[model samples]
Target: MFSPTGEIVADAQRRGVGVGAFNVITVEHAEAIVTGAEAAGVAVILQISENAVRFHDGRLAPIAAAARCVAELSSVPVGLHLDHVESDELFDQAAANGFGSAMYDASKRDYEGNVAATAAAAQRGHAQGLWIESELGEVGGKDGAHAPGVRTDPGEAAAYVAATGVDALAVAVGSSHAMTTRDARLDHALIEQLREATPVPLVLHGSSGVGDDDLRKAVAAGIVKINIGTALNIAFTGAIRRELAVQTSVDPRRYLRPARDEMAATVTRALRVVTLL
Candidate 1:
């Protein structure tokens, strides 16, 4: 059934499990994420990033519609989220298009600016009954720009949530974005501290760089929402590359079918691991 993002996230928090939020770049990605979630019998978040919206020339309706349709049809609970969006217009567009939640990212701005912008966006999002997420600045490798030394302050994270009224907060412990290797070291103690410090559910961005064992530890330490993009993309593109090498067929379905299945398998594994299913 189609679930509200807040409900899904709240359930994860209650169950002490991590909810996997997968980035959807295509219809196939949406289908795979939903199929994988159903297979795992766990609720999942289908995320549409700002860059992904730009990839479709700033038109999010088609992609959002596709994701909503997938969520509606899925046997397991599914929710749609807009991730790492820097603009209010994009957030509004997503909410108008039926996104159950959104992350308003103004992390590049000064602290006060980030708080002000995120607060406004959160207010607007809340008005539409959308769950809101935001991140602290320098949360490690935003858009492939890595500052591994950067870490979010638990006190500041608590303050940010109080000021912004967001439903979730994505913090940096050690992981960086777009990492092909799962070797990022996380601060387990710090994660526990953040969990105690913040009232809202905690989100872990750049989770693709975190290894399986580390991911489990992070969840145990209190990460509720885990955002994964690069790893799934890797699985999908690798499958496509292999399929094309074996067949001369120019049909996109011939290649995309296997790619979708491969991604589904990857998602299923991640869901099982994150949810401890």
Candidate 2:
């Protein structure tokens, strides 16, 4: 059955565990996520990003319908999440599209502006029974993410969550997006501070750059929701590259099978590491 994001995260919070929210680009990605969850015996969230929507030529209904089917058929609980959403147009599609939660990205705006936009969106989403998530600052590339000085303040994060009324908050400790490498160092101290100060769950974005030890430590320090996208992409593409190198095949299924299996393996490992039980 499809799980609710708020219910799952709140359960994890109560149990002091972390849940992986992996990004899904295709129906295969959704399948791999659920396959991984079943292998790890954990509940998870399937994230569909704005970039993914754009990649599908501004059509979400197709992938959303496919993902909904995948989640509904899964043995373990699966929650649909809309990630890094910027516009009200897309965010409004959450409930209609079967997404239980959404991450509203207004970090491009100033603090006050971000608060206003997220607050309004949160209000609207709440009316539809959607769990809202937002980021404090820009968790963009290596430059901004790796800068030790450019971290979210504990007090400010608390203020942002209270002001926006988002059910969850993603903070930048030190992980960059789209990183093929998994060596990002996180500030455990700051994560603890943010967890202590904030009223809602703390999310770690750009988590694909974080390794197993850091992931474990981050969860211990207080990250309830971890977003992983690049790691799956890396695994998927690498498997395809290796398969093509070994054999010649025009049929995408020949290559895509290995890619999907590799991604499923990656997701299984991540889910096991982050989930305490």
Top lDDT hit: 2
Poorest stretch of ten by lDDT in candidate 2: 141-150
Candidate 2 per-residue lDDT over residues 117-182, each given as its tens digit = 999999999999999999986686734445776689999998888888899999989888888888
TM-score of each: 0.97, 0.97
- Cα displacement (angstroms), candidate 2, residue 237, comes to 0.6
For candidate 2, give the lDDT of residue 54: 95
- lDDT of all the models against the reference? 0.90, 0.91
Over 1-277, each residue of candidate 1 has an lDDT whose tens digit, in order, gives 7899999999999999999999999999999999888889899999999999999999999999989999999999999999999877888887689998999999889889999999999998899899999998476665555564458888998899999999999998888888888989888998999999999998998888889999999999999999999988999999999999999998999999999999999899999999977
Write out the backbone clash pairs for model 1: none
Where does candidate 2 stray beyond 4 Å? 142-145
Error (Å) of candidate 1 at residue 67 is 0.8
TM-score of 2: 0.97
